[model samples]
Target: MRDAHYEWRCKAITPIWTGDAYQKNGRMIPSGLLGSVRWWFEVLVRGMGGPACDPTDPDSRCPDKHGNRCVVCELFGCTGWARRLQFKIVDSNGQPVQAAIVKDQEFVFHFTPLRPILDEEWALLDLTLRLIADYGAIGGRTVFKPSDERRRENMPQHKDYGLIEITSWPDIKVEERQLRSYLKQSHWRNMDHGDYAWASLDNFWCANGKHLARQNKDDSNFNRVLGRDERKTCKICGDIHDPPNKCPKNNRYPHRHSENLINKNRTNQWIAGDKQESKKVFSFRHPQRTFGFVNPEVIDFSEMKKRLRKAWPDLKDDEFHQGSDLLNDLIRSPGGAP
Candidate 1:
C-alpha cells in the first residue's frame, strides 16, 4: 500500500506517462488514451465490488478537486513550472538592476541553463525548482505604477519587465502586440485607472479577444460605457450613474464618454474622489477575480525549497538572495511592479 508521503511525492514529481502501454516484467501497464479508459473501467469495477470511494470528500483518495479523480489533472493541474530566467542588463555604471521584473516590454525570452531543450522532461523538472519571484499589479491591476505617496518619497517606479514575445520558442507562440494591449487594457481595472477588471476580462479573454482582435483585427472596443441612458448605480460606494451620467467618476472608460469629458468640474471631481473608491472600483473590475479559479493547488514551497537546497548543497544564502534579486530585476521593468 502506498503511504500518503509516497503518493504525494509521486504526484508531485512524476510526469505520468501520456504514452502507450509498456510491458515491464511481463506486466502490461496501459498508458496514454488507452490507459485513461482502462483506469475508468477499473474504477467502475472497484465501485461495483463493495468498497466504494466517497464522492463528497475532496481530501479523500480522489484525484481531482471535483472528487472524480481525473488522473490527467491529478498529474498536471493548471500548475506550471517556475524557472529562474536570468537577464544581465547593465546600467551605465555597470551595476545590475537586480529586482524581479514582470512582462518586461511585452516580449518573452526563452532561457535555459546551457540551453536546455523545452521537452516534457524539462517542464516537469522546472516545476520542482523553487520560484524566486511572482508578479502582480498594484491598486488591483496587474500593471504597476508608483503611487503619489511613493513618488513624493522619490521611490522607484515598478512596471512589467519581461520580453513581450519569446521568438526562440515557436511552440510558446506569444503574440506581443496582443499581450501588451491585453495588459494595458487590463490596467484600467487599477485604482489609478477606473477599476474595470470585471468587464476587462471579456475584452481581453484568451489574451484579448483572440478570435476577433487577432484574426479579424476587430477595432470595436467591447468595454461597457454609460451611454445617454442606462439604469445603474454603485452599491458599495453609493455613487450613482443616473444619466447626465451620475457616476462618471467610476466609469470604466470615462474617456469614451465625450459629454462627461467636456466639463472641467466633473473631471476634477473624479480626479479628486476618494482614492479608496478608486481602489474599490479597481478591485471590482479585477480580471483575476473573474478569471481566477477557486482553491487552486499551489506548488508546495516547502518541498520545492527542500529540493533546491538538495540540488545545490553548497549554495550560500547570499547566492540565493542574489538569484532572487536577479530574477526580480528581470521581471520588474522601469515603470516597476504595479
Candidate 2:
C-alpha cells in the first residue's frame, strides 16, 4: 500500500443515509459509502466505453474463464482479488466518524491506495465524486418518496437524504486519450454486453434547473419521471393497464410502465433477460437535478428528451447534457465548474 492517500471533504446538504442492515441511522458505515462510490465509478467507466461487470451476478461477474476481471472489479475487488484502495470516513478533524445522519455536518472520505493507483482510475474517481456532488445523491434511501395522499393531506416533514456538497478534493488530471488507451488495453473492454443492460454513459442523460414539487396534487415531477403509479393506455386493447395486465385484444402483455422500465429488477423477465438495475436516477430531495441511463435499444434519445420535457417543462436545451458531452467537458476542464 502507498503511504500517501487522497481525501475529499464534503458537507451534507441534507441528511446522509449510510445505514445498517436494519436501516438504523445512528452510525456511519464505510461499506455503504464505498458501494455508492463503486456504482458511480462503474457508470463513469461504461460512459467512457470501458468494460464494467455486474459484481452482484454470479454468471457475469469478474474473474472469468482466464482469471481476468472487469475494470470495476480490478479496482473494487471480486472473489479472489482485493480492492486496490482502502476507504474510510472521517470528521473534519481527521478522526473516524461514529454517529451519522446529522445535517450540515462535514465529513471526509479518506482513500489510501493499496497499490499504485493508475492516473486514469484516479481521474475517474475524481470525476465520479464531482458528478455526485453536482447532480446525484449517494448512500441509501435515495429512492424514498412520500405517498400522494401524505403529500396532499399531511404534508409531512421530509429530509432529502444523500445530498452532499464537495467542499475540498485533490486536483488530478489525465488526458482523454490516455484514459481511452487504458480502457482499450483491457481484453474485455470490447466484449459484447448485449445481454446485460448495465448503466452506460452512451445511453445516459442528465437535466438540471428543475425541482420536484411535492405539493403538486395533479402529479409530482418525481412520479412523472419515475412513472410511479402512472398507467398508460394499452395500444392493442385501448384499455388503461392499471395493474399492468395482459392486453385482451392481442393476448400479449402491455408495455412496462415508466416505473417498471426505469426501476428494472435483476430477475424480471425482460428483453435482456440479464441483471439490469434502475435506468433512472432522480435527486428527489435535491430537486434541481435529475439524470438517468437508457437502453438506446429500448428508449432512444428523442424519447428520453420528450419525457424530460413533459416532466419538467422549464428544462432548457442548454440545461440538458448527454453522456458523451458531459464526459468530454469533464476531461477538458477537470477543475472547472461542472
lDDT of 2 by residue, 38-100 (tens): 988888887777888877777778888788888888888998999999998998788999987
Q: What is the C-alpha lDDT profile of model 1 across 1-338, one tens digit per residue?
A: 11111000110110112222341112112222222322222222221121112222344333333433322222222124222222232223444323222222222221223323323222222211111011111111221221222222122222211112212211222232432333234212122111221211111111111100001111111111111112123443435343355445565432223223123343222322333533111101111111110111221223223323442355344332222243234224321221
The most accurate candidate by TM-score is 2
Per-model C-alpha lDDT, please? Answer: 0.23, 0.69
Backbone N/Cα/C clashes per model: 38, 0
User: What is the TM-score (0 to 1) of candidate 2?
Assistant: 0.79
Instruction: State every prediction's TM-score relative to the real structure.
Output: 0.20, 0.79
